[model samples]
Target chain A: MPPVLQIIDLKDSQATRSYLTKQTLRSWLLTTDHKRVGLLYLYTIIVFFAVAASAAAVMRLNLLTPRGDLVQAETYNKLFTMHGVLMVWFFLIPSIPSVLGNFLLPLMLGARDLAFPKLNLLSWYIFVFGGGIALYALLIGGVDTGWTFYTPYSSTYSNSHVALMAAGVFVAGFSSILTGLNFIVTTHKLRAPGLTWFRLRLFVWSLYATSVILVLATPVLAMTLTLMALERIWKVGVFDPALGGDPLLFQHLFWFYSHPAVYIMILPGMGVVSELIAAFSRKRVFGYTFVAFSSLAIALLGFLVWGHHMFVSSQSVFAGVIFSFLSFLVAIPSAIKVFNWTATLYRGSISLDTPMLYAIGFIGLFTIGGMTGLFLATLAVDVHVHDTYFVIAHFHYIMVGGMVMAFMGGLHFWWPKISGRMYPELLGKMTAIVTFLGFNLTFFPQFILGYLGMPRRYHAYPEQFQVYNVLSTAGASILGLGYVLPLCYLIWSCCYGKPAGNNPWGAKGFEWETTSPPPSENFEKPPVQTEEAYAYPVPSSEPITE
Target chain B: MNARAILYEQFSDLEQQRESSLAGIWAFIASEIMFFGGLFLAFTVYRLNYTQAFNEASQHLNLVLATLNTAVLLTSALTMALAAASNKMGWKYSTLLLLMVTTLLGALFLAIKGIEYIEDWHKGLFPGSAFAWTGSDPGHVQLFFVLYFLMTGFHALHLMIGMGLILVMLLLTWKGWINSRHFMPLDVTSIYWHFVDLVWIFLFPLLYLLGAKI
Candidate 1:
């Protein structure tokens, strides 16, 4: 038996106690437990997701007709802006990191909690406070500057609550900073005795890389937004071209942070898919060192490519060429990751599990998303497609198709460990299939619409584009159902699902060695790793049953 | 000292706890560098674009008060270092005395900064649309003042946070919550104080000294 099996005999009452039960409301409100904190983030982001999705639903409903039909132009503007702000800052950025990273970083490292658990709780409070202010801004009179808050319009013209919205995002940026700080310190100092750096799991590696970006990039966003808020409040000429300030300067500063902020949104999803691919393939990740290094490469190269977002914003031609080339260079690492994941499944025993389905879907969709990104990187092509549905469709493919799929896959993969219950596998697989189909249906048409010269962010469009918009609306409804189904079933499984024993999928990692729904301090005694990560046995022709 | 060391459940022992605390603060300082780094980047970009305007704007600053404030902040950093050293030696009374001096010096710097701000307001050098300055490239000069006030304002906020942290450390030290062996709190706070000072070190040259000779 493994050293982990030896600790199975050391289990006591504490080992069986679930983190969810037997905790007072006040205890949960003030808890410093990382697991509880992760749950807190989980519950909170889901609510934000619902609000943003409803805004999306309203937009899709209004877009059904070529003429303005559903709501006024102003309301439509606010809808998209509200969707972008809430989705980007409140949902997608924090989705995986605060939820899965918070819950699993300590467990995977064989540590009891993050390096500073109290700071972890404080990070959550900060997120809520920031989110609260943003939500209040939305409720009173929404800002229509879009999420980018591009200057001139945001600073001088827009009459909405720009300051409140900026303040909300500014304060929320620190929560991300604090969480990243916690993970960096935890990963550096809290590993088990025998767990060497190379022995670390891919998920942990990805989280570490994500943390680096979060630490470095978020503060830039904070500062940029601060400048934006100040400019709006004081009518400063910092970004106002009328007052000798260059608007391109605003674009430079904004994309300097916002572009890397995209990676911040997706890198954790890449990490989650890494874990899912390995577990389902019953093999170690092929080219582990190359795959691990690719993450850092993406993070570092991610910083250089922010200039690409400014290609059409009056940026100089030579600068555009340099940024375009750097953008292509960043794509190399993402391709490296995709190819490595495919090689890991070669001749290996691949299980068509729910998580594996989502992982495979992520590979296909992200490739399409990433390839379209290359087209956008080309200066000539981007000038044609900039500010069109093409840009919208391209990012949605990456953010929604790529990141959201991986998030679902990971949540399902780890749900048993998290909730100590089995969420009917057939239902899980169905959810994955529906989401993949619905996602493609929703975004694939937007590409065609964009190519045919349909501009984005407008309340209405020409009559010829009505069919594609109708198709998109149809796909969005299906996608909304796809999302709602999982949310319902996952919550149901928390209470009514069958009990999940330790190592339900027989996955190889320090996390699975502990009991499902791990105790308050993560482990009864700290686990010491005795073998390499993903040390599954070689495949036999006869399928092995659980 | 060994028996008195307070170890959290996450760490295996007090030594590991101390190492983690130090690493955590260093990571935080790295992020802080990036936070201030953004403003510096903006300053460099605008300075390169509008060189004469930035220099003329720099001439308007109260260099005497800024220079004095810089010295005061540097002296506080010295006292902060001495306090950490005293805490390491378990010299509680000396640590308290050094901390008090550091806090007083920090307050003095803020006082000097307040006087400078009042002087600027009287001169109508603030970034609003008010009419007072008769200088070349008034628009770009306003840009310079915007950056000057924003950078210094944030620095003052960080100093206030440092003061709060020092007060907490002082309370903890007096209540026997921290000792020589368990002085990681003091160590981390001093590192943070030094970082605040280091940002001003960069700020002093960039804001006050950069366009002085020009």
Candidate 2:
């Protein structure tokens, strides 16, 4: 047998013993284990998925017959806003890094727990508390402020439970800040012996970059929201246009945090796709340091591009020009990542597994999504596309199409360890296929509809838009089935699926070197660093980096 | 024979774990700087935008109380830092005493802040309904006060939270949960306390010292 297989067999035998014990499960749930805390975050975000998806369902329902047939146009507006708010803050931004990054970061680096376990758990609770409040706010009528929570409308004009929903978003913002702080502190202080700066995983580097955005970007968001809430309650003139305040200032402040927030959403997806691509291709990622720094580069450049979102919204033309040029520059690092992933696949033994399929879906959709964004970035193009379904189609491609695809890829990639059993592979592939087809069906035609000058947030569109609406609504149904199928079987797999042997997929990482389900401690003894990340077939000599 | 011996022997890694937490808290304090740094960046940008409005709005603030609040917060930071340092120097009582003083001063800042707010309310300087600014283009001037209330209001909220935490530290110290040898509490508390001070260091210039005539 091969040397790597020998090691794999050894871990499988060990996992068999641990699986029979009750202590591991109890230790995971009640204890202050950072790994366990990460798992808890994973569990909570699925609930976010269920809630956010329902909001999307309502959005699709409203558009089915058009002309305000199914739900009132006002109901339609509320539906989309709720969908945007729940998904962006709750699911996409926090999903990969907070849940998976928190789970895998310390373990991959061989730390015992995070530098602060209590703080780790506290961040999770804060996240759940935030989600609960937002859910409740939605239950009691709804907040009419778009997820962006724009000024004058959010502050003074439209009163649809503004305080409750704003408060919910406020709490959620703190959770993002706290989690980012914990990850930064952990990466700084908690690496295992000899896990030097250069020797770290690309995923860890991406996570560190992400946390910086979270800590810095999220607080500004929190303060911005607080100012809005106060203006709503205290009737402050800070952003009230009638009171001589520039409501545009609120737009400037909001997109300041929000534009970087998209990076916060997508950077982790970028990180997850890195692991997925490398693992599936069975090769060391090309230009490793460049790929790592590119994550940091995207994060840095992301902050400079917020004004592009406001180009047609009365921002100074000089600011618009700066933001426009920077927007083009930001795409360079993202292109570098795509180039490296493609290079990793060159002359490699790539497989078509469930995770890899989703990874491929992420790449294709993310590219199309990214390309469409350039149209919105250009001054002339933006004038034509602004506030149109072209805008909606453009972002949903990146967010729902791109980020959500990577999110599922990650869920399946890490599930064997997270749950102590194997998910049915055939069933997994079906969902993956459905998700891809359904996603494309739903959003692709909307791009054309948008370019044809159909405005978004309209309950009754011109008869010309009906064809596109029919396509979108039809796609949503398949997408809904794609989403629901996994929830059923993945849960069923938890109790009765085949036992996942340790290292079910032949991979070379310390996480794979552990049990199928890790022990309560995650490692029996402190894992010593011995190999560089993503070096396939287990190199016998000359470990890369430090 | 003593609690120290038992703490070390029983857990076997208690001291190691506590030191890790102390390290963690200091790292968290660093993150806090960067977090507040973002707001400071925003303030810097807008301060550049409407300099006259910013200065005129600062004038509406009572400088006496602002100066007094600055002194009080600075003194509290000093006490809090000394509290952490004294624990390292093996002075448990001094550490506890400094913490107590820090708590007292934090409360004093809130008290002075409340009084200033009341004075502003009477002067019709609040941002919203019943705002008064004697100038041409009073609207942008009102924006300055809106920002003033927001920036200072946020700082005040952080102060209140810090006060609550310090109270918890006081009770722990009194309960003998804190000591010279096991002083992670003192260290973490000091980092937070100093952060509150640093916030004021920026707030002092931005809110009170900027655009002052005398």
For residues A143-166, could you state the per-residue lDDT of candidate 1 as single tens digits? Answer: 999999999899889999999999
Q: Which predicted model would earn the best lDDT?
A: 1
DockQ of 2: 0.39
Give candidate 1's error at residue A327 in angstroms.
Answer: 0.6
Residue-pair clash count for candidate 2: 0
- Per-candidate clashes, comma-separated: 0, 0
For model 2, name the residue pairs that clash.
none
| Candidate 2 chain A weakest ten by summed lDDT | A13-22
lDDT by residue for model 2 over A287-390, one digit each (tens)? 88889989999999988888998888888888888888899888788889888998888766888889898999999999999989888889888989999999
TM-score of chain B of each: 0.96, 0.86
- Compared with the true structure, the alpha-carbon lDDT of candidate 1 equals 0.90
Off by over 4 Å in 2: A1-30, A538-546, B1-57, B129-141, B174-177
Predictions in order: chain A TM-score: 0.96, 0.93
